[model samples]
Target: MSKPALAVLLTRHPRKPPNILQTLLEVQASLGFVPADALPEIARSLDVTEADVAGVLSYYPDLRTARTGRHLIRVCLGESCMANHGAKVLDRLRAHLKIEVGETTRDGRVTLERTYCVGTCPVGPSLVVDGDVIGRVRPDQIPALLEEYQ
Candidate 1:
């Protein structure tokens, strides 16, 4: 985002308390993803170190320093999901999307990621597309599931 926008957002909410996390969230909400250029300004606005802002950015999986694709596909690779052929599903997704975990597709349509769990162990191979958790995912279902996002 532009520096002017950051200044406007920072000074916009004087009535509310100044907090590091809240400020970052607001920035992310407004800008889609927190821009790398935003760290210094965010730190200055919150009176925290730039490292503080960067740390929060790295610590939170939801807070991304870079912009993501139009759709995010995160497949669960936890123990149960692995047992249920989650790895196979992930491989199929990788091959279909032509991108590895933590990378966005060339067309910027989708981003593929790997998560330890989605809290549905019994379902095993679970898939989360844009925050919607889907259970019992299979390798064959990968194309249809991804097609929805496309």
Candidate 2:
């Protein structure tokens, strides 16, 4: 099935103009992260200045301005996970995928990200693939886990 058009699903007009940050947040939540071109679209739709839209988007660390992959792979970098070799896990994945932590593959298969916490402390060195949590990740196991999706 085709995924829902993120922009239309996210925007909720409350009979008043959406605040600068609110509009962007809605877009981010639905679209995964805001695209660079989305700033102009948001400004035109909300009747807000382009600068205002850009400012709000830049201020939020959770928002990304780049194109992303189909599946978002978020690895916890929390203290527990970090101590358990989370960095090595991320590095191995990056090498196997041939992409940086924040980048997607050429075919747009996956995007790698380092998140602070996924609230799975007991499962340290955890990895979340498209919102499905897998705990106790070992560096060597990343390739086999990713092979399933291929």
Candidate 3:
């Protein structure tokens, strides 16, 4: 089962502090999200407690514990993005998709999520569509942006 495979992720971590981050990232990459059921397995593999695994999972915004859609849309709402009217962009998406930030479209084509920042604050109002960082996002552009994915 994949749970056993998850242990393989930590096999290379011999003497260092249990690098749970990389292991969890790999798990997420394979399963799309870290299944709650695998938490104990991950901890046992790394010689840490289940709480440690859960802590790392909850601490990282990029990590997700729930299944998302085929296309993951992460909108930035950091101070810089919000100052640049990022909320309007978020509102437009919510209206267009008729789904809130942690929701997937009924058809499961798209999943909308909120991110603090994508490190493009200089441009502000940035977002990520399927891992591609986009800056200077205007509300009017949301339709065309989503069209490409939908």
Question: Candidates 2 and 3: which is better by lDDT?
Answer: 3
lDDT of 1 by residue, 9-53 (tens): 977765445577778788888988888887888788777799988
lDDT (Cα atoms) of all candidates against the true structure? 0.85, 0.80, 0.88
Model 3, C-alpha of 7: deviation from truth (Å)? 3.7
What CA RMSD would you report for each candidate?
Answer: 2.2, 3.6, 2.0
What TM-score does structure 1 among the candidates reach? 0.86
lDDT of 3: 0.88
TM-score of each: 0.86, 0.80, 0.86
Model 3 alpha-carbon drift over 4 Å, by segment:
none
lDDT of 2 by residue, 1-150 (tens): 013354454355643656877776777766667877666767867787889888888897678876578788998999999988899999998899999877889999998889998899888899999889999899999989998765
Best by lDDT: 3
Q: So what's the TM-score on candidate 3? A: 0.86
Better of 2 and 3 by TM-score: 3
Could you give candidate 3's per-residue lDDT for residues 4-113 as a string of tens digits? Answer: 57667656555467788988898888788988998888888789999989999999987989889989999999999989999999999999999999999999999999
